[model samples]
Target: MKINSFLLILLFILMSSVTSSSQAKEKAKHVIFIGLDGWGAYSVPKADMPVVKQMMADGCYTLKKRTALPSSSAINWASMFMGAGPELHGYTQWGSRTPELPSRVVNEHGIFPTIFQLLRDARPEAEIGCLYEWDGIKYLVDTLALNHHALSPDYTEKPEVLCRMAESYIKEKKPTLLAVCFDNPDHVGHGAGHDTPAYYAKLKELDTYIGRIVSAVEEAGMLKQTIFIITSDHGGINKGHGGITMQEMETPFIIFGKNIKSGGEFSESMMQYDVASTIASIFGLKQPQVWIGRPMKQVFK
Candidate 1:
């Protein structure tokens, strides 16, 4: 009888340990970051962006009420990646001029270590991939040395190429951290203006692209282990950003995935830098001391 009791206790202890380890592994979540360039809150109510709307309905969302300096792509993208403002990352505009250096874009130096670099340092086994417009990822990861792949240079053909590349990466690479950027809305908004038919068409195309990404993840059986975040770098007004207007500054923060609470919007004003900090926190990474923003803790349930 004593031997039987001892064996039962040992079994219980082993089961408990296994359960605890499974929970820990679940906590080690994967993240998919989608950056919609020139996407504004205005577009949300107007466009038939079903995927994004569904994400908002099923996940925690916050009104990202903030503005980017110079309202340029490079500056804001760097801020979002580094979790630091222009002052810290040292890229304040799309075209920046340093004394003694000719007027050049942010991609010229490409020396700063991005969030991916930090992730690599903390968890060397973690797989990371980036598909973006312009030099956002390159500047962040210092692609000059890392040999990181980008979609293409021409804006006209980039989105389609990006979709194909992302599909291939997700299927083959199974990255722990993946970031995809869509620039259609931003391009059309600049050329045709917001709320126009052209802008709406661009948004619809972008939504279709988003659906494809989600479908690929689901097919790979990674949906349950993935945390998806959809947001914009900054909004625009009259073909420009940087202005403090609500349409230009106030973006959306939509998050959905396993182990996340759903069905609510956060009213608190959050900055762009908070995105980087939140991502870092999600992976148990140390937030940069220089980052002034805090993680959106409300999303995790």
Candidate 2:
């Protein structure tokens, strides 16, 4: 009787462990961060971005104002991914003159470890990938030793190409984190103001690309397990960023997908760094100590 009771107890313990492990796996969350290089909050309503508009309506959005120092792409993107200010990241502008080199040089090295690096270390089992037009993010990914795939510098891609790449990564690697940066609207807006017909057309093109990604996720059957976050680095000035104007500083923040409460907007003041922190929280990882921004917990519902 004693031997039989001991065997039954062992079996019960093994079953309990298996059940707990399966439950933990079921609760795992995946994140896809979509970056619109130069989108601004003020332009979102007017811009004909149907998919993004629908996401805003169906999920949580924040008119949460943004301010970027040196508002340049290199600086803002570094700040956003590193979750630290320029002072910490040491990426003040697009170009940093190194006294060691006689000629002017661009500073490609960011000072702090990026959120990607932290995630890679904390969650090695999680697959990760990044598609970005800027070299700054690539530098961060390389420095952090994170797993990622970058887009070409020319920012040229057929809809099919982008879709195929994303689909293959999700299907083959099953990455828990995916980051994509689209630069069309930003480039067009810089050449032409947001009100221009060209800018509106670019917005529509961006929406179509976004729709493709959404469809791909749905088809992959990962839609319910994924969290989609769409945001921008900084807005543009009259035709460019790196300025103090509201048009150049304020941007949009939208979140959709599993576990997210629908239909709400946050008008409170927020910064770009919030993106990294929020993503960290979604993965059940502790925010990096160097991260300065607070996680916008209200958006998670």
Candidate 3:
């Protein structure tokens, strides 16, 4: 009987350890999610994005992260934010301002529940904002949930201006969550063709923008308390996405700062919806029952 008791105690201790390791030691005070529209994992090898490369080295990353079917902007963006694919969230088209199909569920805000909505509902005082070059992002993120939301004048002509605005917002508000979405890469991809010189040049430019945002966070004395996530809506082919090609479906997902594993590469399969779930986990917020995303908890140390 004593032997059985001892064995049971050992099993309990093992289970406790597993549970502890699965959870973050401390919840993040700030999470910066940077979305690069149409940046493909295939271009990572050839692009001169030193800032992004450094992020990959410093954090847990996966080049194999996948977008939802019909790899396009609005559909995958909804998946990333809503924590479910088109069938569930119902934002099925390339640039859908509203759901092409009926959403399975919605929150008090009267739209699909997004990470922003989740945070707002749970922590009413938490500062949440988003700055994007794409106007369509407003519809996806549920602007009513955000404390602040802005659309850049023109991404292709003045990308730096958007970055500066993001920097200023970070330094001033010290937001609990901030999403900076760049539409330049996708515009360039469609205009000059994906995997071309212009596409790479555009990516390089956006990398500088990311660097500026990181600096702004550090300048605000929130560096140690902040987590950074970089990902994309979809990739592209010759001139467009919305297809099943590897280039269109595969995008890089990088998570760095504050309790993340250093130089770790996530080998597990991850979906676009998982990004929202991961953010929810970092904030220690309970995910809505409608969300199908599973957090990439292995990224935490």
Candidate 4:
């Protein structure tokens, strides 16, 4: 345990030093990570996703990004949140139950601290918010303590409400971080078939909400200082996942912000853990020593 803490401290110091020297220009004040659950890589064609296309055109993106193994929500999301694979985070099952963590580890006594836990620990006064349609993510060990959070059975009908709340929070509290998850596409994909019209329609509908919220951010004049990181936990089969098929493994990763470089190569491979690392990089947070992935520097200015 002593070794773990020492390593983390050393890593934090080194990363902070680099960040201060190399990444000090145009540091972001807010970061919004939008996870479109089960969003397939091929499903985001320009014809169907105008808003997404606009965002991609304004940022760098990869439609070939791969998620973690097993393709399960609990596993992939856990990996994304804690920047650890299933072997480290110990959450390989489904359902809304707290994760089983190691008996001992670093970071405020939490074995594998989620970004939410780390942010709250580091900055208690800084506001943070999250809205998720997948309830399973609500139970990650120390995730229950975020400044603002909301979960629904699914994102079918009432997701707009979550968006409204997120917009309100952005305008009212100006949270340091606001994460939102849309689960309706995955829900409809499972029942109707990932390639079916219903699934595509659901994604399009969700895209409209995305445009609305982003417009809210723009209207609030936060976009110039805010970073937008978008991706998915995993893709799905016609309506199911948890398999290793290409459809179930591939997802799209996008990064857009004033400081981020635009129209860059989108061919670099990325993993689910890189999502959190990239966000950490944007906010100048020291990438945790336990996280194996690094920021996609190709996306930064």
Candidate 3: segments with Cα more than 4 A from true spot: 1-26
**Candidate 2: tens digits of C-alpha lDDT, residues 140-242:** 4434445668664445545335545666677666668888877656777778765578777777887887888888787778888888888887777567777
Residue-level lDDT tens digits of model 3 in 23-114: 55446789999999999999998989999889899999999999999899999999999999999999998889999899999877779999
Give each model a TM-score.
Answer: 0.84, 0.82, 0.91, 0.86
| Clash totals for all candidate models | 0, 0, 0, 2
C-alpha lDDT values of all predictions: 0.73, 0.71, 0.92, 0.76
Q: For model 4, which pairs clash? A: 190-239, 194-238
TM-score of 1: 0.84
**Once superposed on the true structure, which residue ranges of model 2 sit more than 4 Å away at CA?**
1-28, 95-111, 153-160
lDDT of 1 by residue, 1-301 (tens): 9999999999999999999865654443678898888888767888888888888889888766475666656667766776777776677766442212322223234444456766777776777878876554555544433224575467685557777777778888777888888776788888988778888888888888888998888877799888888888778887777677888877888888876788668776778878887787778677656666677777777
Q: State the lDDT at 19 in candidate 2.
A: 89
Report the C-alpha displacement of residue 197, candidate 4, in angstroms: 0.7
Candidate 4 residue lDDT tens string, 1-301: 9999999999999999988886584368888888888888878773277887778988899988787877868778777877777767677665526455452244564546677776676678878888787776676535554777877543455657767866787888777888887776778777888878888887888888788878878877787888887788888887798898988898888878868788744777788877777777776677667777667877877
Error of 4 at 43 (Å): 1.1
Better model by TM-score: candidate 1 vs candidate 4? 4
The best candidate in terms of TM-score: 3
The candidate with the higher lDDT, 2 or 3, is 3
Superposed model 4: Cα runs more than 4 Å off = 1-26, 100-106, 109-111, 152-155
